[model samples]
Target: MKSEFYCWLANKLPRGLAYWCAIRVMSHAACANPAQEVDTLTPAQCLKAWPK
Candidate 1:
């Protein structure tokens, strides 16, 4: 539900801006400690499921 809501909100934003932001957030996550385990898929992964 939260992801759906956020996606709906993101649809209100410019496509270029949204894509740029997603890339930045994913890059930031990639920079996180490699040893750390993510309990769930990151937002970037979820965003990937969306159609461009």
Candidate 2:
């Protein structure tokens, strides 16, 4: 992602410590939802399984 995007996200978070917290939160969400095969889970199930 671009630094400008990061900067924008950082600013959108509550000022101060919340900025770092937001980064951590985003990282955790990404880690929890690592990319995978959409077909493996079946079509109806895949929507719930994958991140938006």
Candidate 3:
């Protein structure tokens, strides 16, 4: 339901503007949920943690 509304709204927007809006929304959500555990890792980090 929410995704449907988002898709409809995004389609109504210009392509680039829709992408920018999505990025901004995601950034805001990440900031708002600082305490959330995010195990995001760089390629180097991932390799270092990989099992032998």
Q: Which stretches of candidate 1 lie over 4 Å from their true place?
A: 1-5, 34-52
TM-score of each: 0.49, 0.38, 0.47
Best by TM-score: 1
Candidate 2 lDDT, 1-52, residue by residue in tens: 6989988976787676876664555555555556744234333443344466
- For model 1 the local lDDT of residue 42 reads 71
> After aligning candidate 3 to the native by TM-score, how far in Å is the CA of 41 from where it should be?
15
Q: How many residue pairs clash in each candidate at the backbone level?
A: 0, 0, 0
lDDT of 2 at 3: 88
For model 1, the run of ten residues with the poorest summed lDDT: 30-39
**Which residue runs does candidate 3 get wrong by more than 4 Å?**
1-9, 37-52
Number of the candidate with higher TM-score, 1 or 2? 1
Candidates ranked by lDDT, best first?
1, 3, 2
Write down the lDDT that model 3 would get.
0.58
Residue 38 error, candidate 3, Å: 6.1
| lDDT (tens digit, per residue) of candidate 3 on 1-52 | 9999977887899989878865555555455456643344333443343445
